[model samples]
Every structure is written in C-alpha cells, then in structure tokens.
Target: MIASPDDVLDALDPEQRQVAEAVDGAVCVLAGAGTGKTRAITHRIAYGVLTGAMQPTQTLAVTFTARAAGEMRGRLRDLGVPGVQARTFHAAALRQLHYFWPKVFAGPPPQLVETKIALVRDAVQHCRLRADRTELRDITSEIEWSKATQTAPDDYPRALLEAGRKPPREAAEIAHVYAAYEKIKSGQGRMDFEDVLLLTIGLLDDRPEVREAVQAQYRHFTVDEYQDVNPLQQRLLDLWADRARSLCVVGDASQTIYSFTGATPAYLLGFRRRHPGARLVELVRDYRSTPQVVGLANRLLAHATGEAAKHRLELISQRGEGPDPRFVEHSDEQAEAESTAKQIRKLIDDGVRPAEIAVLFRTNSQSESYEQALADQSVAYLLKGAERFFERPEVRQAMGFLRAHAISSGSDPEPAHLPAEVRAVLGNTGWSAEPPAGSGQAREKWESVAALLRLAEEFAVKWPDATLRDFTVELAERANAQHAPTVEGVTLASLHAAKGLEWDAVFLVGLNEGMMPIAYADTAAKIEEERRLLYVGVTRAREHLTLSWALSRTPGGRGRNPSRFLDGLRGTGSARPDAFRSPGAGRGPDGTVRPRRKVGPVRCRVCAKALQDAAERKIGRCLDCPSDVDAYLFEQLHQWRLERATEHSQPAFVIFTDATLTAIAEVRPLNERQLAAIPGVSRTKLERFGDDVLALCAGHELAIESDPDEFEGVPEPEIVPDGA
Candidate 1:
C-alpha cells in the first residue's frame, strides 16, 4: 500500500518535507549536490496518490538518462507507489510519438535511427565535404543542439553567432551538413533521436485531440535534473501540462554541465517568474558526502561566476566529518599515473573495494597512462563512459582508411606537405588541425584522431622520408599491443561522466592550467562552467578525495603549472625529503621542488642569465650555453640507465628522470660528493648506483654488476596527504 501523506511527509527533511507537502500547482526544488532530491520527489508523488490528489496512472516522472529514469522508478516502487510512468525524455517522447503517429498523419511512425553517426556521415558525403570520425560526431551534436533549440537549418549560422556556439567546423558548413542530413534522413523514411522529440511536439501542436489526450493522461508531472532540460524537452513538458500546471522540477544550477547539449538552467531558475505561485523549496542538507567534501564543493562554487552560480545553494553536510581532500604535485605525467595507481592499490588493500574508487580526468586522452600505470601495479580498472583507444570504432575505421590511402599512393616521392597530406587523408574520417569546441563524445573522438596525427608528425620528424605506409604499420602494432578494458575494476571516467554517481574515494588527475578550465574555455562563462565541472568532480567523493597535477607532460618535457582553480586550495610548505612514496617530489636527488625560499630566479651557470625553462633549471644552465656535456659520458650513462630500468622492470625515467640524467651527463660526477651535488640524485640512488656511476664517468665499464634483489627492502614512498 502507498504511504499516507503524513507518513511520507514525516520521512523527509525540513526542506524536502516542504517539497513533498507542496503537492499542488507548480513547484521548484533547488537541490544541492548530495541532497535527497530523489527521496523528496518520490515521496511527493506517493503522498499525492495516497491523499487522493493524483492518480498513479496519470503521474509521469521524466529524467535525463535511462539509468536515472530506472533509478527513479525503482525508488518509487520501494515507496509503495507503482504504476506511475517513469522514463527519460527521449523514451517518453518516442513512446508518445509511436502512439500518436497513426492518429495524426502517418500510416506508422518512421523507423527511428539508433545513432546519428551513420546519417551524419552520409550527410557529409552528400555535401561533398570532408570530415573525420570526430567531425561527424561534432556535426551530429550540432544537429541535435539545433533541433533541441528549434532552430531551422537555414538559421543555424545566425543561431550559432547569437548563442556564441563554437562548433567544430564553420557555422555555415555545419548548416549545409545539417540541411543535407535532414534531406537524406527524410529520403530514407527515417527519423533520428532528435526527430522523435521534434515530431512529437509537432503532433501535439498540430492535433489538439492528441495534445488533450496526452495532457489529460499525464496530469501530475515531475522532472528530475531540470537544470539539464533543453528547449525541446521543456516544450514537451509544457504540452503535457497545458491547462493543469501540476508540475515539480528538481535541479541544481551548479550541476549544469550539459550546455553543450543545449540544456539550460534558465527554466529552473525562472520557474518562479513563469508560475508566480510556484512553491519553492531549497534542499541544502546534503546526505551523500561528509562536511569536508561538502565544504570543498561549496568553496569551488563560491568562486564561480555567471547566472548559474548566482543561485548556487550552499550545501550543509548531514554526515559526520571525513578526511580533507588531498592535493599532490608530481614530476611528470607518468609519475602522476604511477602514484595514483599506487594509492588506489593502497585503498583497496585497506578494505575499500575496487568499484568504490574512481579516477576522473578532463579528457579521455589522459586515460591511457592511468590504464597502463594501474595495470603495471596489478590493479584492475574499468573505463567508464569511454572505450579503449584502439577498440573505438572511429580509431579502427581511421586505421583502415589510412592503410588504404597508403597502398594507393604506391612509391610516390615524399611530399613536402607530409603533415598536410596526412591530415587530408584522415580528413575523410574527420581529422582537423583544431580540436572540437564541445565536450563529450565529439571531444573524445577528436582527441583520438589528434593522437594519430601526432604520431604521424613524430614519425615524419624521425624519418624525413617516412611514408604513410610505414605510419600505418606503426599504428597497427600499437593497436595490437593496447590493453583491453577490465570487466570490473577501479572506474576511470571523464568528469562529465561522473555526474549522478558517487564513490568512496575519487582521484582527480591532470589538474594542470590548460586542462581543468581547458585551453579553449576562453570566455568568462565557459571558465565558470569549468569551475563548476571541477565542483562536480569534487562532490563525487563520499570520503577520500585526492587532486593532483603533473609539472610536465613527459619525462623530458618542460614544466607545467597546476590549475589556477587550485590557487588557494593546495598546501604551501617546505618540501618533504621523502622520495620512495612519490618518486620525484621535493628537492631530493630524484626530483626538483618549488620551494618557498628567498632565492631569486635560477641563473645559468655559464651565462649568469636567468633560466626559465624547467630543463635548464635542472642543469643550472641555459640551452645556448657552451658545451660542457660529455657526449661519450652521456651515452654511457644513458646505456647504464636503460639497463637499470630493464632490470627493475620500470620506465627508464622512473630510474632517473630525463632532466636528472642530462644533469649528470653535464656534471660528470666523479664521486659521492660530486654525484650528491647534482639535483635529482637522491641519497638512496647514490647508495644504489653511486659507485657504478662514478666508475662509468672515470671511463671504466663491465664491472661490479649488482643484482636487482640487492635493492629489496627499500621503503616505498608514502602518498603525502595535503591540506590548504
């Protein structure tokens, strides 16, 4: 039996009780992260059914994703309220379209295309334009955005300018592609996911009978994730509640991360203006995370600007205190990944299940190193909301496409525009110099193509005459070697994919300046959205949270700074001497630290000029300085380092970072005193390799081979927890 109104109301928090009690007319629930919005809304529906205010069959609950809709249905069932319809906007609209198609104009509903990729690809071919897989996805997204906003193909260009949309391609080009896509879709007697919503709206608008039936059938309406409702969804909702505006919407503008999909928080924010008597309730009591996590989330939003942040709710944690979020700075991307994997292993060993942990990043491209690092540590991991790089359809297709082009070229001399030629060949699959402007699948696809292009560039640089055929072979080898995703393991996901989900622990990796706010987050509005994105990541953790960034992308690359969003968040203290816990942290021999000292900018030892590059800082010299590096000594050190790395089964850089190796070669350390003076040559490393290194510098070889087992019993570095 359904719970009574009093019984339902008694179970809700004060604000949630207000949300459940205001069961008539229009209502708006300003729910913050971790708040019990789901509980409040489900109880409201049950209370209404129990009090004879609404019928079960007539109530409809709509959300963004199928998983969310299913969750809502499950929650409603647990509340003793069954028979109420719960579905995603697409599912509900598709069902209504099928039911009303015969009544309106068609013999039967047009066959719905499962995905827009094929159709969009066909449209690109029809328009005689070149697009790679990424471009095709971007075009598909643009069409969806256009249809959701009710903008016609002819007006897409103006719409883009008006809305400040930076599409992957030119607005005019996208419009042509959009127009061609519609024509082809119509010619094949097929409709897309977006068309389902558009056609349903058309049926309701054109046929009053159909509109009345739907409106009368669904009298009480509730919307979840209302902040993510696009114009098309709002139109459908309006049609469903035409005369009787018995509606309830739950959303947090702070969680609005789908603007790329044309979703807007305007409707949720303006609900009071639309319905003057709408009951407004603010659910600030967060039931998911502890006070520490909640406080960080609130602080993240406090720095946010723009309209969405204007109405941000300050979440109060209902749970007890938890560990403060930690921030770690690493030497490079590889170090960051390894450190993250080690921590995940520690968490699992400490009783946290693998599935209870997640590692989130800004882009899918960053997942590779983490995947490798986790595997290296023997920790299982699953890719959430993404596919393994090699297994992606776009990547597989591009490989085939490139191989075909390479065969067709057949013995031609190297073209001067090798990079351009490679781009042209991949353009058929959507390769471009610039990346996609939007997030999600389009961005992920673009990153994949960009990686291929980067490989081609590197190959061309290495062998000036290397042909397309050679590059294809290299790619095949990589694809064959790429690891398959794990079935059940630690979750690796993009921040966008982590929404509506929580974990016992979360590691937010790759928080560098160009990434978190993203390099293309040019405008103030977009930057604010990036801040909100970080906020979303922060709130996903229920207990343990660690945020980290690397100083460089590769072993030998120049330094990169942490994200500005973390300016006031990370700890500022003297560097720790520990090296084993995190390999390249602090002023130890293994890595350099950004210490708080009275020293001026590092100067070149030779020129006495200020040195800016990280590599130069490590060597204490400018790049243009006269040659002090011994070529033979450097080669010997490199060989020795490689052998050590092989013996240890670790990356060469892990044994000695590129900068450290270069510094050693330049200094040509003769003994313990000289070797100890070099940066990145830790005491432990001196004890381990000092004698061998000195002998090599003194032109002696093939002596004193040490066993790898001799290095056993060395303590691993502890993952230092940080506080602001």
Candidate 2:
C-alpha cells in the first residue's frame, strides 16, 4: 500500500511540508535554527520512496558530521525508508571505493599505514635530531590537523611556518614514512581509515566505467549543513549532482565557523548559481528556542559586522519562556565559576536534566575553572562534542596497540577485536610523540604511552573474545570509567561545540571584555567573527540565557568589565529581557544595553600631563617615575609609562599617549611645542587655552594618558553598505 500524500503532509508542519513536496526540481531548504528542515528533508526522502517518485537505492542524504549522518539515517529508518544511504562525505566515499577499488588498482588495494608518535620518536632518534618535548608534541598536532584538513606542506602559508608548523621535515620524508608504513601494512594486508575515502575518490576519478556504474546506483541526494563543504568533498558531491535533481539542502551561513579547516559556505550561499532555476525555501520560525532567545539572536546578527548577520532573515521562536535572563558581574574568576555552579545545582534540584543544561565558554582552556567548580559541587556533567570517544588517553592507546600489531606485521594481522571499518582508519596517526634522550623526560613520555597500552590491556583482559569493534565500543565506557555520579546535572562545553544543539538552561559564562568578543577583535573582520560567536551562544539556550561577566582575574580586584556586547543588559535600566530583543539578548526596550559613555581627560596636576588613551593605557600618579626618567624625552616618557605599568599591573601607555610621549621626547617639551606643542592640544583645546598645561604643571611637565585625537562626536553604527 502506498503512503498517501496527505499522510506525508500530516507528517510535516506547513513550512516543512513545502520543502518535503518540492520534488519537481532543485530545492534549497534554507532552514534557520530550530526549523524542521531536517524533518522536511527526511519526509521528502520517505515521500519519494513511498510515492514511487524515487527508489531507496537511488537516493543519498549527506551531512557535515558522522554523528549527524547517523541521526539522519535513523530518522529515515524510522520513516520506513531503510535503504537510503544517509552518510558523511567520507563514509560515502569509502562505500564507493569499496566497490570500485579493484577496477582502479588492478589488485586488492594496498592497506594504508597508520603512523604513531612512537614511530616519529623512532625517526627522530634515528635522525639524531635534538628536539624539545613541546616542539615534538606541537609537530605531531600540526601534522594531524594538516592531514585532517588535507593541507600539503608546500601549500602551507608563511604565517603557518612562523607558527612553528613544519610539514613532514622533507617532501620525501613523510612520503617515505607513509609508504614504508603502508608497505609494512600491505604485508599484513590491512587498510587505514582515510585510505577508504582517498582510495575511493581515486577509483571513481580514474575509471570512467566504474564511476558511471556507481553513479547510476544512487541518483537522488540531500545534504544537511550544506555550508561546510570542503574542497575534496565538493568534488564527490559534484559527481552525484550531475544526474540528480532530487537534491535538497539546508544550512545557515552565519555559523560558518569551520573556515579554518577549509570548510566553505560558498556552496550554500551560491546555490542558485549552481542550479540557476532551483527552488529556494526559507524557514524563519525557530522551533528550537524561546522567543526571548530568538530575539537576542536576531539583534546580535543585526548588530554584527558582516552582511551574513545584517541581512539574515530573522529566526522567530515558537518555544515558550521560562525565566528572566540575568547578567551577573562577579569580582573574580573563582567567583564566576562558583556562581555558575550554584545555578547548575539549583537547576538540578528543580528537576532539570543534567544534559539539558550547558555551560559554554570561549576556549577549551576556560573549561578548567568550570570543571573544578563542578567537581567541587560534586556535579556529574559531560564536556560537549569533545573526542570523548576516540581521543581519550585510554581509548587512543587501545586503538594504538591494535593498529601497531597490524602495522608491525606488515599485512592484515586479522585482529578479531577491531571492526573492519575502524581497522581501515587505523593506518594513519596511531602513536605518541617520543622524547629525545639526555634532553630529559624520555621516561615520562614513554610512561604516558605505556599507560595507554595498560588501559588497552585491561580492556582486552575484560573482554577476552572482543573484536576491534569492542575497542572503539569501550570508549564511552572509558569516558564514564569513574561512573562518578548518576545524578542528572549541567553540561560544560565550548560555544563552538554548541551549534545545532539545544539546552533547557544555558549559562554563558565569562562574558568579560577580553574573554567574549576577545581582545584580538581589533580588525573589522575579526569583530564580525566575534559577533557571530555571540549569536551562536545566545541561540543555544531554550529557556534562560544568563548573561554574565567577572570584574578581574585576581580574587578581589574590581571585576573585569562586561563585554561591550552587553551594552545595556548589566545593571538595571538596561535593555529589559523581553520577546522583542534579538535572539541573543532579546532584551526588552528597557533592558537594551546603553553603550558606555566616554570619560574625557583630566590634566595632570604636577606635570601638566593629561590622562592616557582609554583602551591602551591606565590612570596613574605623576611622581612614580623610572630612575632613568627624562621628563624631557618622549621615549623616556614611555619608559616611565612601562615602569608605572609594571608596578600597577596595567599596560604601558596608560601614563601618556604615544603621540604625547613622542612629542615629549622629540622636543624635550619643557614647554608646549610652540603652544601647539602641548601634545594632543587641538583647535578646541587651543581656543579654550589648551596650553594651560604649563599652569596645571605647577612647574614641571608630566605625561597624561588621554587620547589627543578624539573628535567632536561618537560616530553612529552604520545602517547599510552604501554601495551594495
């Protein structure tokens, strides 16, 4: 019996139904957060198969992450469309290679080799090169990220080189390592994981007959998170797109954060360019978050620097509200963490699930303080999206030993424990970095790898008859090895890991000046990236988004100020937390963050110097001079400024403006540079007797920190790209 069209329609919301039934041609389901774009795509696949519009084997659904691919497949299976190969690009490539390998390689494909850190150490020792442990560790990490992103050595830019990343030592060096590593493996006849995709793509491209045969097998396609297509992956997608009009895609351009790994949003943004007459559908209602959350997201994008946010279609939320968002300011880091812990504990007591909450921060390093706090509270929580499964010390070691046994044998060792697929991947990156001799720390280094082996051995003893599959399987068990507590609690994760995920409660911690938008956000492009991150953080909360900040790192120093993004939401009289605020702050009119007002200069009483530039300098006393202080020299003024900064834990230049310091050193300005020489004295200042500096000095000239070039007014945020 055929599933009725009405049944399919009933399966989807009205907005989702439009995408599901858009089967006549190319369709772009440009879904924003929380929209049922994934649902619509699933129903579309089910509809196509059930209605006899397409066969199960004829369709493909692709996603950014393997986890997402698994979710999509499960959804399809739930819909009774079991044959649809919803897959990650890599997985899809491997499938193709499995079928086409014989045609391209002329024999059973050579097993790919996995290289471990021990081997690198072996190579280093054999090469007699003296390397520091940190240097060795960084080299391994660099090679891993490079190979993951598929960046070749010659292609690495100058900046990367300066960052201390060297590629393979020599061109032939890595090739030799890889080739020898493979030779040893081929003798054992086992395949590496990446070899699957690399070999598969190689197969389809080399043999036309095989490529066509495989292409004919799957004719329709759907891709989720279409924006993150990398270079090599795009080529495989292009092959399928050639004869398929059943392709459907959904993604958001604003969350294009993986640009570092060669992921590009060009595919999503320029979809129409690829299929000129394609149908485009956008779902604006955000079913994933509360209206207040949605409101904040909208405003954040509205204020964000780039066209991505400024021109985005606002995501309206249908989720219900729960709590008034709070922006707490603490005195220091410990207080920030402790306060957040209190919120988490309270939420759990109120019956919120532990997994339902997330504590997001800017960087992984920031997780330490929160982890400590959570431990202190005896909270059981998981770090979001970490390689909790694969990269754990024990898990990697188990996989390492098995892969090593396979490698040492030079062919398929026919290991019973590892899954056939994982064994394929075991060829590349299976070891630890070795410590150099006499340089010290070799034992420590070897012990770490040994501990990993010990964990693996423990697993093997426990599961005597286990397969390679069991090794990867035990990862989650290993993660929960301590089984610390059974209570549901809060989650701790990075803002980057929180995308496409939702939490009932979210505490966005560390919203301080240097931590949120971050200090490096001086350039226009960087500022926009920071804004996008804030948008991501705000959208992750389904109910409450507690905007927070700390005043300082020291235990009781004046707290570091809130991020500028908090413009009005800190104390009372700011933008009120309301449905009207953009999805980020979603502050009500009253809660809107009022931008901070500038405090102009105060002339120095003893030296007649004005104060420092607000951002780059500090407020300091005049007589705390450096022993080398030359009141007449501007460079000497800088020295004095540094001396003061060292004493006060503030940056240099707080004592005086660079221009003022330069003027002082150049003219030894015992007096103003001919009245105009009063550094930073402008037309207004001059008209107002700016040269009164000498009078304020009482007798001697001291440097001031105020900005000399600040003009008549604060500029308004631009409303549009004038030309565009």
Candidate 3:
C-alpha cells in the first residue's frame, strides 16, 4: 500500500518533521549521530514526491557508502517512494560519466584503475626513485591528499609546502612520481577513482548541454554526510544543482572525521554562506545511546577545538539512565586484553547477549592480542573489520587442497613429513616463494597461505599423533563456524569501523597515549580528529561504556600513560560512578601504602626541567640539557631521523645529527620560520620536521600550563638552543 504524505510526516520527530517538510530550495540539516538523519532525508524524499514538489526520478540522494545508499533506497522503498535515486557520489558520477562518455568525449571512457598501489610502484620506478613500503604508502597518501585538495600534480609541491605538511620523502621526489603516475595512467588510457569526479565535473562545467541535461533530470538533490564532502565533491554537487539551489544536504560536523581523505567540514560549515536563504535545521536528539553515554559524548566534544567544534550540537539524550561509563587501568596490554575478554564473558553471563557486546580499539593492529585472549578463553568472537582466520580465501583454498590430498591418500600422513607435505600441497596449488609482480592482493594471499603452513607446522609439533585428516576436520569445523553470519559472538572492531554502530556493552581498549592519539598524530588538527573518533566510540554504547588503558606492553617496561583525552572527560561537570580505581593504591607484601606513582608532567632528566611533550617526557630529557632528556622523545626524534635517512636511502645521523635535535629542543622554536634560524636545522630538516617540532613543543607547553603541580620538584629550564 502507498503511504500518504501524512504517514511519512508522522514517522519523524518534531525536528525531523521540520526537516522532512521543507521540500523547496536549499535546506541544510545538521544531524548528529543516531539522530535519525536517514529517516529525515528518506521521509523528505517521500514527502516531496507525495506533495508533487519532486518527482522520484528527478531526485538524487547521494551518500558516502554503498551500504548507506542501499539502506536509503530500502527506506525510500518502504515509504512507497521506491523510484528515488539513492547512490554513492562515485556511483552517481560514474553512471553519468558512463552515459555521457561517447557523446561528450567522442570515445569510451578510460578504464577505472582498480589497483592504484601497483601503478604507483610503477610510477616510482619510472621516476627512478627508490622507495620502501612505508615511503610508497606515504607517496600514495600524498597523491590522494593532493587529489582531495584539488591540487594537480604540477602544483602539488607548492601546495604541500604551503600547507606545512612534512612528506615522508622529498617533496620534489614525491611530486615527480605523482606527475609520472598521472602520465602513466593517462598513457595507459586509465583513470583512478578521483578522476571520475574530476572528469564528471569538467564535463558538466565545460559542456552546458550535459550540465543542463543532468540538472533537468535530477532537479532535486539530497546529500548524506555532507561534512565529509571534499572540494571535488562539492564542485560536482554545485554543477549538479546548476545554480538552481534545489539541494538539501544532511550532516553532522562533529562526525567529520574524514579530513585525512580530504573531506572537510568547511563545505558543510559554509553552506549558509553559499546559500544565504537556505533553511537550516539541527537534529540534536539522539535516540541510540543512553543519557549517560550522550553526556559522555557531549563532554568529549566540549574539549574539541575546530570549526566543527564551533558548530557542535549538544545531543539531548532520548533514553533513560544507564550505567555510568567505567574507566579501568591494567598492568599491560596482555592483562588488558585478557581482562576485557573476561568482562565480555561476564556481560554475557549477566544476560546481555554476546552479540550485543563489543571490544573497540584505536587501530587494527591492536586486535591481535585481544583475539588471542578471547580464543584462550574459548570465547567466540568476530573481528568486525578483519577477515576471520579460517575464512581467508587463501586459508580456505589451502584447507581444500589438504582435504583433497588426504582423501586421495586414503590414510593419515606421517607427522614427521607434514611440513614437506604442506609445502608440496601449496606448491602444487600455484603458490610461489616470491609475491607476483604488481599485485598486492596476491602477495597478501600468499602471506595468508604461508601463515597457514606455519600454523600446520605448529600444530604438528604440538600434537605428534595428529594427521592431515585430523587437521582438515578441525579446519572444516572452524571455517564453517567462522563463516556463519549470525554466530553469537562478541565484536572486535577498530574505532573507525565502529562509527554508525552501537552495542549494549562496549569495551574501548587500548586508551594509552601513543595508541589513542597515535604516535603520528602530531598536529592540533590531527589530535582533534582523534578526539572525534573517540567520541564516536563513546557514543556507540547503549547501556554500558568501559574506557580502559594499560601501563605498558609488558611487565617492568616503561609505563604507558592514559590518553590526554581522559583528562578532559575526568574534568567535565558530569557526575558518574567509577567501576575501577587508578593503579598504585597499595603497597607490596609489606602492607605499606605504595608510593603514589608520579602523576604529573614529565621532567627533563638533565636539568630536571618539566617536559610537557609526552614524547619528550618519555625520553626523560631535553635536547640541550641532556642531564635528564625524555628518552622516548629522543628515541622518537632518532626514529624520525632514521626515516629521513631511509627516504634519501642514506645512513642515519647524516640526515640530521643528534645534536641538531638537542638544539631544536633547547631553542623550542614555535614554527618552521623560527626553527630555520638555528644551526644544523638545515633547510631539509626545516621542511621535514619543522611542523612536527613546533607541534611537540606546543603540546608540552599546553600540558604544563594545564597541570603545573605534576611538574613539582622540577626546576624551570631556560629555552635557548646552543646557536640561538
């Protein structure tokens, strides 16, 4: 049955209704996470079609992901408005490009480049520049960054320098490779993903007829996640509208965490500037998380500083009270992981389904320990963004080959020759000692197969009586279980993948300083993005939220500190119950009160000067006043120096002497211009580490001012580099 317009309007709350009913001209809906932004936009399309203000075929609903687009289409279908076009920006643009290619370009469009990294590797070889994996990753990142910023290859170096970004390799080298990459791609009659949007925009802008046709066909446009729209996307959006202002965009600036991808909230933040008469609506009511969770999210954002932070919408929680967020500290990463798995088990025992519990971490690498811990406890768990061990294609294929071999043999193979048998099986199945040329996926698949062989070797050693048949049976059972979609298991996911997802109980693991903000998040903007990511994780809890960290990776190692983000949450006005106490509450067997672990700013080991930079604190000394240098900071500087050495493929200390870092730390220059004045701080170093050095010093200073008592007993050291 076709639902009436009233039926569509009735589904939304007051704020959403206001947005859904606004069917004309430019409308911008600032929808927060879990605010039913999807419902608002879907309902808006339905209302438009029902009210004769928009035809389903004339409206284009653009989303960022295919999953989101499918959901939008499904919701529109449910609303009796199935014909509305809902697709990703790429999908929409690709469709138009495909349709108009022969007419506009007078030939078939170039094939889309599916494997960019391979092409980039070729570009590097063509440019005669040697690059390692890290450098290659960074160069590709630079290319993406350049494309996202709408900077052409010829202009990349200037734009990169102006932005004060330190490329992993020489800017000129990267630029040369970028230009070569473009040339090679063009020569091969191919286009990368970014070229789709760029080409579509160019076609629309240069050809009036094409623009008019598109504008005429899609007269009304609705964009989801507008805050993440890059400049290229924004230009395409503008061209699609053809200056008619029949565009509605929905996004939450606070959720704008894709800056790394060249997505800026600038477009969303400046929407009103472009359309002064645009109707604005804010969806602040959050229906996903509990009030406690909502309060925590609000507190987290209260510390954010950016354009997105400036326009932050405080979410009004729609649900009743739930458990206060918990903070737990552990002795090390292993203890943290084991304890987390235990907590999941406890939550499951307490009536919460295993599927309703999640263990979220900052990075994908952090999942390994947790997976092991869960497996040790025999807890069934799914790694959300990772392929299951038994489900990997390589693993499955190897298992199939093993099973067939075992069946053909009609007997158990001797454990002594199992290693050879496994190798022979893999070799027969086209496995190679070296990765195939220009195919990363093939290399990864080979690695997966190699891993399975290693597992088999280990299994053979662990169980001397085991046969190939035994291993095959075990593998079959595991694969079947792992491949089941609805298996009852806890979820382990990275924070990035946890966005737009919620759970009844969430354990946010690995909240340590270097892990949370990450060692590489060295700038204010990067830090803010990290904060937003944490906020997204915090808001994913419906009933319970547990924030946790560990002191170190192992026992008796240098202690890792909790994230600075925790300080903001602790200082917030919100009141909540604590489930765990900070470490160092009691003494050893002597029954004495343990000396309180120094909980304050780091002091330079040399002069005992308080060091604010967490890295500096870790190093335990200042650069010049090496009496008490922050060892970690020194190590980090050394590592960065080594990376620079590798970029030139030269020896370390040749790029920049240790004394140079000392001078930099002593001078504590606040910017590249200032840093360049110091001796040994060469033009290359200035270009490479200038922004990083300044950020480090600034972070330390801020930390000191925020909590001076932590620096008690430490004398204030003068900031003066040797030459300065």
Against the true structure, what is each candidate's TM-score? 0.74, 0.61, 0.68
For model 2, the stretches where C-alpha displacement exceeds 4 angstroms are 112-151, 158-195, 385-483, 518-527, 557-559, 568-724
Worst 10 residues of 1 by lDDT: 715-724
Better of 1 and 3 by lDDT: 1
For model 1 the TM-score comes to: 0.74
Q: Across residues 1-724, which tens digit of lDDT does each residue of candidate 2 receive? A: 2256567778677778888887657888777877877888988888888888889988989887887888888888877788888888867776676566666667766544464454445545544564455345534444444444555644445434443333424434443343443344445666555455556666667778877887788778888888777666777777767767577878887777665455666778788888888988888888888777777667667666665664376897776765556667554565567667767767877888778989998755466456545544446667765523234443456565554554454344455443333434432333343422211123323333433443344344333433444444343333332234434546777788887788888888888886677664555655676767777788778887787676565332343577877774434332253222111122235853422222233333234454332211112213343222234343444555577545433334323345455433333323343434333333323333334433433223322324323322322211111110
The global Cα lDDT (0 to 1) of model 1 is: 0.77
lDDT of 3 by residue, 212-236 (tens): 8998888899999998998888889
Better model by lDDT: candidate 1 vs candidate 2: 1
Which of 1 and 2 is the better model by TM-score? 1
Best by TM-score: 1
Among these predictions, the greatest lDDT belongs to 1
Q: Cα lDDT for residue 86, model 1?
A: 93
